[model samples]
Target: MALVPMETALQRLLEDVGPLDGESVPLKDAYDRVLAESIVALRTQPPFDASAMDGYAMQGADAQTTDGELAVIGEVAAGSTFSGSVEAGQCVRIFTGAPLPAGTDTVVIQENVDRPADGVIRLREPTAAGRNVRRAGLDFTTGDLLVEKGHLMRASALSLAASANHARLKVVKRPLVAIIATGDELCLPGSELGPGQIISSNSYGIAAAARAVGADVLDLGIAPDREDAISALVKQAVAAGADVIVTSGGASVGDHDLVHKVLTREGMTLDFWRIAMRPGKPLMFGRMDNIRCLGLPGNPVASLVCSQLFLKPLLARLGGRTFHQDIRTATLGAPVSANDHRQDYVRAAIEERDGQLIATPFGVQDSSMLRTMAASGGLVIRAPFQPASEIGDPCQLMMIG
Candidate 1:
């Protein structure tokens, strides 16, 4: 079968992904969750026209001259209301957030005023109407949509909603991603390993990627390369209410590769297998009972790259958050060879000189190596079957964080 193009595979994967179900959560826990619906203000901010400064609230005309003196009819602090009207040359001593008494149109800050006697203060600076005042609904009025649907609840957004009188918010449910590692030659990390065996490491990276997008993960542990063993774990992930199940290793054409067959036997309708990309050729995508099942190659680098290219965006979309690759153009600092049928994602170190991005790929391009991939800040994108290029040639790159 012809390998699927990277863009086409992504499009197909996204088409079957639906936004997560909605749930109501307390405002405190709603931060970083995607809003499921628009949040309207429950009540007007400030509730009434109030003083914004801790000083005398009086008519602007009376506070224009430094010699102006006004008898403080009464004092109003925050949460206190004064109903009596203040006439010309008479001011009310009001604290910040206090409701502006009737007939008060301006405020003179305490620093700009002088008091020579009890309840008697003189203006030392000019004040203007509406100065140091927060009018009713200045921040948000009743029935006003403060946070729109599909918005990722950032710190500022969450605080804004809370200030608008929202004690709770409706947010999309976080999808549960289940990760399973397959290989008889794998052992859990921190355990003593025998010859021909290695520590299973795919779940940790896959789960972290899912969590970066706010998705929950149910790590199903290791499933050795046995039909019954793999099937049992698949059933376990489904029973745990996982929205997506991912298996790393056993995806290639080797005799030990059994992920594709296992998923199909478990009722997964195969969408596509084998993407046209270096370090991730054996990547497989499918669905089973509406739950996504991704089969990623055993190579550690392949698994991580697939998680970044496919898993992150899939989870982000379902969580109602926007996702995009940070692709940029750069000049090659070293010569590069031609590609074959698969597109190349050469791990490279990037630097900027005079604001020009320069990409330098490591000497070795082995997909199984992790040391070089870790030192890389981005991947230099090379199209499939492209010709060789010399140093200083322009190319596109996708930044990784």
Candidate 2:
């Protein structure tokens, strides 16, 4: 089969995926969830004219002059209203958020007034009308849009929704991913190792990647390199209603590579296999009805690279969230020789010097080394069939976390 380009593979994977159904959740539980509908203000903010500062509410004409004197008739705090109206020579003592007294158009800050006697105060400074007063609907009016659809709920967004009188919100359902690991030589972590046995580590990284994009993961444990064992887990994934099925190992043409055979036997229609990228050239993608199946390479670094390049975007689209690769331009810190049929994603350390980003690739480009992959900050992207380059050459990098 001809190798598919990386862009073509990604475009095919995200062709028909979309957000799942909406579910109603409490405002407290809606954090980090994608909004399914626009939120409208239920009631006007500040429902009525209120005081913005601790001051005395009175008629503007009565407090305009520094020599004015007024009698304080009543006091109003937050959540309380004054029943009596303010006349020319009368004022009401009001605190922040308290409703302005009837017939009062201004609030004179307490600092600008002096109390000469009980219930009597003299203005020390001229006060302007409508000063320190929050008019009705100052933040939002009734029936106004507070938050738009497809927005991710953050701390501020949740607080704003609550202030808009929304106790519950409609959010898109999180996409579910089922992961299966297959290898005869693989054993669970912390197990006594036999000859030619290694711990299964791909599922852990794959699950973490899926959850980082807000997708729920179901780990199906390890399956031996047998067609029946792999097929059983695939059926279970379908029964559990997984939106995507990710399988690690057994994707190449080796004798033990049984994922492709089992998935095809289970009625999967293959989309493309064997991409043109280095380290992850054996990657596979297909669909078994509504469930999307992704076959990843056995090498640790290859699997992770494929996940960062392909799986993250697919899951983000299915979860109704936006995603874009953090690709940046940088200069090579050392000389590099290139010319190959496959695209390369060389793991490198990035540093900034004199406002220029420098990418220094590791000595080895092995796909099975997970420690080097972890220590690297990003991958320097190299196009196919490029000429050899010297030091300080311009390069593009994809940042990884």
Candidate 3:
């Protein structure tokens, strides 16, 4: 079968998967969550006109005289308000954040005045009118939009919401992904493996990939290459309320590839059965009763690459978060062959030599080689049907898991 184009597969998944419902969480716990509704401030900041400095609140005109002396009638600290009016030559000692007392239109800094034995201070510098006062609602007015819906709450955003008198926030729910591994040749980690069996390793890598994008994963363990077993696991995944079900191995056309048959039997409408991507050709995608299903190939590297290409974005959409791969342009370190139908994602180690990104492809591009994939920091992309290129030629690359 022909492979599905990259654009078509992404569009199909986005069009079919709906975002999960919103839930209310405490303001302190809302960090990194996407907001589901706009947040309006319940009260104005600097609720009352307040002083912004430690100074003596005085009338500008009263300090213009030769002596510049004014009596400190009262002391006002933060949260304290003075109702009495300031007479022509009277002043009040106020701390920072204290409400500017009634009848005081200006302030003279304590450093600029002489606090003598008598309760009086002199203006060492010329009085500047209305210089140290924070006007009412200086930060934000009541009923103003502090944050909008779909905004991802970060440290600053959460603080702003709390300052707006909100104790809780409405946020999108996290997506739960169910993972199932299939193959009779698979054995659990740390088990005594028979000569023919390999460790069931794909689920761990897939689970980490899912978590890196904020989706929760439920590992369903390994199943034999039997239609009954695969079908039962698919049904369990559906009943377990997984927003996405990722099945590793058994996704291709071999006789033991029971994933495709079981998913279809469980009502999955196959959107696409394959993709034009190397090391990951059997990348199947579909939906079953609102739950997304991704049938990933058995090869370890293929499964991981498919997760980065497809699974991340799918989970991001469900969780109401934005996701993008870190793709960059770089010059090849050595000559490479090309001219294949599948677009290749060659494992590579990227480096910077005098600020230029140099991508060196690994010697072996086999799908089952995990050591090379581990050593690689990224993938150098090679287009389909392109001729072999020499060193220093430009290529595109995407950062990996």
Candidate 4:
């Protein structure tokens, strides 16, 4: 099969993907979840005209000037109301958030009133009608939409929803991705490695990538380089109702590569097998019914780069969130050789100098070197068949940091 262009592969992978079904969750647990339904106000904010400050509430005309003394008819605090109305030349001692007594149109802040006697106060400043008062439905009226669908629940959204009297929220279900590592030579970290064995590290990075896009992860541990071993894990992922199954290693055409054959045998329809990109050329994508199956390259750096390039966006879409790679323009800090036919994603150190971004690629960009990938802040993109470039040349970068 021919290698697929990077753009073509991405388009095919995300062609029909969409947000999952909605599930109701408590408001406390809704933070960072995408809303499946717009949040509507169940009750009006400041359901009644209320005081916005600690002051004396009276008719605005009653305290137009500082000379007149008004009799304090009663006192009202937040959560309590005065049963009687304020007559002419009368005021109520009201605290912040207290409901305005009948016949009162304004509040003279305590700072602007002087209490000459227990029942009399003289205004130092004139408060206009509705001044220091929160009118009924001041923030939002009942049935008004406060947050739109597809919005992410952040601190402000949660607070607004709670103020609108919402105890529960409808949010898109977070996508679940089941990950499997396949290779006889791969072992868990901290294991006493047999000769030629290496630590299985891809699943950790892949899981982190999945979570950063709001997808829940299920690691199925390491599967040996055998079809039956891989098939069992694949079936487990299906049984667990995972929306996506990510398999690390076994994507290439080598004899030990069994992921493609096993997934196809398990009823997955191969969407694509190889990509026209450096390090991640063996990338595989398929579908088994509703589940998306992605086979990433075995090399550690390739696995992580592919995860950043592909898995994040897929999971973000499934979780009802928007995602875009942090690609930017930068000048090369050093000279770079010409690229091959395949597109290149060179790991580089990114720094800003004199308001311009500079990307200096590492000397060796071998796919197997995880240390270089970790140390690099971004990937400098080189299009296919681009000529050799010199220092200060303009280039596009996909920022990772």
The most accurate candidate by lDDT is: 4
Q: lDDT winner between 2 and 4, please give it.
A: 4
* Residue-by-residue lDDT tens digits, candidate 2, 1-401: 99998888999999988998899999999999999999999989979999999999999888798765799999999998999888989999999999999999899999999999999999998988889999999999999998899999999989888988899999999999999999999999999999999989999889988998999999999999999999999999999999999999999999999999999999899999999999899999999988899999989999999999999999998899999999999999876787598889999988999999899988898999999899889999989988787779999999995
Q: Rank the candidate models, highest lDDT first.
A: 4, 2, 1, 3
Per-model TM against the reference: 0.96, 0.97, 0.92, 0.99
For 1-401, candidate 3 gives per-residue lDDT tens digits of: 77887667778878856568999998987888888888999989979888888988877676555365778899999988887888888999999999988898777777878877588777776766787888999988899999998888899989888888999999988898999999999999999999899998899999998988778889999989898888888888888899999999999999899898889888999989888888889989888877999999999999999998889999988998889999988889988997588789999988889998888999899999999898888998888888898899998889883
Q: List clashing residue pairs in candidate 1.
A: none
Native-vs-model 1 lDDT? 0.90
Candidate 3 runs further than 4 Å off: 16-18, 62-66, 188-194
In terms of TM-score, which candidate is strongest?
4
lDDT (tens digit, per residue) of candidate 1 on 47-130: 998988899998877877776578999999998899799998899889999999999888889999888899788777777767
Clashing pairs in 4: none
Going through the candidates in the order shown, the clash numbers are: 0, 0, 0, 0
lDDT of 2: 0.93
Off-target runs (Cα >4 Å) in candidate 2 are none
C-alpha positional error of residue 362 in candidate 2 after TM-score superposition, expressed in Å: 0.7
Ranking by TM-score: 4, 2, 1, 3
